[model samples]
Target: MDITSPDNSYEIVIVGGGMVGASFAYALSQSFGGTCPSILVVEASAPLSDKFLQPSFDARSTALSFGSRQIFEALNLWQILEPQVSAIHEIHVSDKGRFGSTQLTREELSVEALGYVVENADLGAVLNEKLKVSNHIDFLIPASIQQISPTPGGMDLSISTESKRFNVSANLVVLADGGRSPICKQLGIEQSKESYQQHAIITNITFEEPHNNIAFERFTENGPLAVLPLREFEGENRCSLVWTTAERESENLMGLSESGLISNLQASFGNRLGKLTSIGEKFCFPLSLSIAKEQIRPGLVLLGNVAHTLHPVAGQGLNLALRDIDALVTILKTASENQQSFGSMQTLQTYVNSQKFDQQKVISFTDVLTKLFSSKKLARIATRKFGLLSLELIPAVRKRFAEQAMGLSRKF
Candidate 1:
């Protein structure tokens, strides 16, 4: 419900009501049913309206793994999201100007689709709409957490809205505010960061031919270029593009004319989707691997990019965050059943411990893939070539690769 002023206390307070924060609130509320805890979501930005658009709900699209689809299905949101998503029946991975290439198909995995792609705005709309009407959640938008301090029983938060400022307390405080989190710093949480020294150029491109529900990941000398299929727009075939390039090269690419940019992109992407007909507004951001040294402490926990920010090479960042949310919600439900404090050290630790392996594996996979594919060194190139060849020739290896890409590795 829309809250003008928060209550004095809550069971859980989530900072930042973006995708990650809102998803957790919805999932937690559903999991608890009638015995739901008092949850408050403090969002710094205004909600999406006819006049104002939430920045998080920009034009960019996210590739949701099959596992993420399952999570949303369990939450009863898949039906609402499915209509706006483009299913990926197959993924084509190749090394530009190289002999080795591999393809992972849904038919081979015996699944409906490998993954699904949805526009950020569409997904955000669904989540935000749910938040506004949720009976168990108090969503405070266009508000900020001015200060957060740990208490013996929980955490105390000072929040500021347009007309008023108030203080509230929670048994558990979840930090989902993006990577640059001042609250995390205030709480003395440190991050271990590694800069890839690369920038990702993102845009949507229209092609002459249909994509056939295929997503392409091509490793070029510039960096890893990904073209994921998108739902047709105005009767035109379109796909989302994320091209990772060096710091210097990104500026040059972003400065080119639309036609010039398409020409360069066509040269790198080849004729997979026929001619690249048109391009959208371009966006660029520096790539890096950033992980918080402490994800859980006392009555506080970190979620989303505040916990870990990864390379976009494998498109694992948001998917991993979703998995983390699922695990935390499950653990909290168990704790509630056992009559335990939701923010106790033991409970929070259990949530972190349960997701450690999955988190590590995905982080390592994305980091290594980014380095290996982005490097021009002879040794790295040779290793990747052999890697692709193995994935293509060996059924067992291919299955494992496909499972990871489909976010099913944890199942086995």
Candidate 2:
């Protein structure tokens, strides 16, 4: 749909309308409070009625830390999305073939829940609905950015739409498409990537017993596996499973029959919730650590997975990106109030500086968890046991771990 008038330009343009990009649009519009700059969102694909149509919002589930819930509350979107989520009241962590384990409860953290797990489809529906009702956002869907050229005052984007080809200029361009964005490559931005030689199998599973809203993180020789609580389906105890294993192993498991897979899963993860009676669709993809070295430049910025894609071991990837969006909104609002160039290196650098610590800390934490838990050596096992016990024995250590995992330690 050719909605934009000829010669019309925007003050800011968001290249992706995925979760992070949509959240940034909403947060920025809310920050301006009806007196906002002209904003445009160029989305390559139409808003999919079936969430699985989009890779970013699919059959998988996401764990929203308490801090993320608050951020949603600030934007007034939490109430609409809350009922679709299953609260994570407690977290149980263990190591296979080991003796040490630890537990984190909401009571210890003084929160109603440690986190909430919601289907990717549910979240995508909420975000799409919110963006639809927003008057300040001009979203162009089924469009792609053919090329990008940096201008003195702003950036120029050559966008290809179904109807016609057009060019738009914006004072600021936010690249939140994803980690593997071709737009980044067009702009000459380079990302340094490190592959883990592992893959995660994601699916929704049903168990015989009640999960009691407890999330489980089990370390195995293959990789870190997580089972997050999900809302019950048809009176069955449901959970979202992320099982990490070597690439070849993942391929073999994905080809097995449902019964065979369930049997194997039960072996790795004891029958904590009794038998895994059934499972929904399955998805598997190779895991890696991709970090864009340069995230900001004059008239441009990178957000979300485009900036950094982390291992799923900690469920901190999206949570960390939301935090980055929050910081960018704060910086942009302040810059607007001061009449400074929001896309200037000075302004963008401020955001980079403010979020550096939080980003690095989360990245380091997840990386360490992957390397430590992925190990099968005696020393690594002993260290992991000590780590688990420390979390159990020391309230302070537990508190810090919980706070970080809950996305509390880096609140904007």
Candidate 3:
């Protein structure tokens, strides 16, 4: 093995620079009192200065729950990201060709807006921009981790960039490199995956009428469709669409012409937003429930999709991850203040324990919703109707449901 001298060592090192990982780095840096801990973030994809390739930082839109908004504001990133986001004043959820439907509005929840939708690429730009000026964070892009070894006091990592190879050691290694990361596999971190046999076709579609900042989540015969409102571009009413269907149907849909696909969308999602005028390019990806069986091991920890990948039914994937990030940052800041070994099993376990409940709750909720709403059985249909009705008519139930959708749990 060609082991060279260490390039540098850090108190903390994040293995990915996607949403969750990048946010954690910034949050941790901002929370420090005086001297911030030395932090390093390694990303395989090219930096924003070049061509970025991380799927998590793509053209697809991500819904930021109200709680996620708070996290950003607290980190002082909201100002940079707010311009690219569209506020979701209301969420209309219904079963296609069914009688019962529910509408959750910001007014009813007593919030300015339920959530905000921002393009992944735009958010990435903001994050990368911050990284460029971050004094405490050493951000490296177009780099990959070849191997990781647990050390007595910390962890040693071998990374490759271009034709160069180097090593770096850190007290902790945060694995936020997305689901199905080979590094996690190499570490023998078991993952339990439940394939949904579904694929989501995501795109942006312009509608005839203004979205009026209203989002729609309609459960159809094939699957669920979400139309999240977007900021107007040149006075055009736009919305980001996530249409989930069977894998086979998704393949067929991808081949359809723009007008054909728009027709299919209009058919599945009613005329609530008037006619579909135009659509951007469509992209499809499989859906599943994949959770890391073990989140922490000695000097290593998992974050973002690496820890859990959920169905995007409730737009809870990123929201839940952000919440977990918040908890991890809280724990790490306290550990730093106390001069504790942040990589110790005890400190890492504290993070795992704190994030365990929220992770499970959100995962179970999304998984159940995926199965329940995807079914066409009479009993399931009736249950779904009841679910929507209860969510709307009952005050207490509505509040709880709203809290879940807005990512406001007890932890917050």
For model 3, residues 317-396, the per-residue Cα lDDT tens digits are 88988888888888988887788888988888898888778888898889889999999899999999999989878999
Q: Model 2: per-residue lDDT, tens digit, 145-173?
A: 78878899989989888888988998999
lDDT of 3 at 197: 97
Tens-digit per-residue lDDT, 232-276, candidate 1: 989999999999999999999999999899999999999998999
Q: Pick the candidate with the highest TM-score.
A: 1
Using alpha carbons, what is the TM-score of model 3?
0.96
TM-score winner, 2 or 3: 2
Any residue pairs clashing in model 1, and if so which?
A: none
Instruction: Give stretches of model 2 more than 4 Å off.
Output: 1-7, 48-53
Superposition error at 93 for model 3 (Å): 0.7
